[model samples]
Target: MRFASIGSGSRGNGTLVQDGDTCVLVDLGFTIRETEKRLARLELAASAITAILVTHEHIDHLNGVGPFARKYSLPVYMTPGTYNREKIGLMPALELINCHQSFAINGFTVVPVPVPHDAKEPCQYLISSGSSTFGILTDLGHITPHVAEQYSRCDGLLLECNHDPDMLAEGPYPYPLKVRVGGDHGHLSNSQAAGLLSQIELSRLQHLIIAHISEENNSIEIVRKEILATLGEWQGYLTIADQGTGFGWITLN
Candidate 1:
């Protein structure tokens, strides 16, 4: 299996995961044109994607989902609440996913895990094909036991390190906004993300991509240093997803 990110930040987010003949997109936060450009950067085309899995109804994650799906005649899977809350322009194929249910579309298996976020029935995803699994956990405030269990055995993970508490506390965001971001239902701090990493079994983990960083309150240097320190003795490749370039494809066994 192989995975790559289109972009990761408050501005927008998208990830492409492929196994054998099946390719899927998790989130569509850019316009059709921009998505095309990003895909080209990775040597991928719109027609290659088999489906789009939406995590929530946030604008950054929903901006181009409907249009892109319609344009490509691709299927979109999300919770009923998220579907109802989203005002996507139009869609040709849409499927409402039930939280906690395991389903397969095309040749991939999807496990939707519920998350606590300020959205209508938001959920993160764990995708598997053959013997490999990829865990994508972002835009959630806290990690529940269920989440920890589901993600503990993944071969590759795209974890969110949205901000640093100290930077956010002193950064330019307003007081309430700061509180919300630092609260239990906003975003995960660098420490929180690192803490989750410590709990996962790292022996089989080949790559770790830190994603969805806040451009206004966090810097790559800050997150890199913090996460590197947290690694301690674990041997794994680490990469950061940028708002513009995201990251290149990394394959797992």
Candidate 2:
């Protein structure tokens, strides 16, 4: 299986995953034209995507999902609550998903895990095929036991280290907004993400992509340093997903 991201941050987020003949896109925060351009950068065409899986109803995550899905005639999957708030005219095909249930589409098994986030119905995804498992954990305010357990064994993990607590505290965001970001239903701090990595099985974890970083409150250097310190002696591939242009394809064999 192989996966890549167009970009990942508060401004926008989109991830492309492919296994054999099945190609799926998770989240769409860019405009249709922008998404096409990003896809081209990765040598992909928009029409190749078979489905779109939405994480929540947040504009940064759903902004382009409906438009792109409808344009491409791709099936979209999301929670019922999320569907309620979405503009139905945007998506050509829509599928309501249960947060705790597992569904199969185009030969890939998708398991949605509920998350603590300030959204109508937010969830993270765990995608698996015959050979590999990929986990996408972003937009969550705090890590739940269920989430940690489900994501522990993934072969490739895209984790959210939204911001550095110290930096966030001193950043320009107003009092309430800052509190919300650092709260239980906000976003994960760098330390929190690093700490979670320590508990997971790193032996089989081939790739660790730190994603959803706050441009105003965090830096790649800070996140890397924290993760390295938390990793102790374990050695693994690490990359940070950027907002302008996210890292390229990561293939797990």
Among all windows of ten consecutive residues in candidate 2, which has the lowest summed lDDT? 85-94
lDDT of each residue in 1-253, candidate 2, tens digit only: 9999999999999999998889999999999999999999999988789899999988888999877887888999999988887675656777999998999997999999999998888998999998689999998888889988999999999999999988999999999999999999899999889878988999989899999999999988899999889877776789889999998999998
What TM-score does candidate 2 reach?
A: 0.98
lDDT, candidate 1, 35-54, per-residue tens: 99999999998898999999
User: Which pairs clash (backbone N, Cα, C closer than 3 Å) in model 2?
Assistant: none
- Report model 1's TM-score to 2 decimal places: 0.97
| lDDT for residue 249 in candidate 1, whole number 0-100 | 93
Please report, in order, the local distance difference test score of every candidate based on alpha carbons. 0.91, 0.91
Q: Which residue pairs of candidate 1 clash?
A: none
What is candidate 2's local distance difference test score?
Answer: 0.91
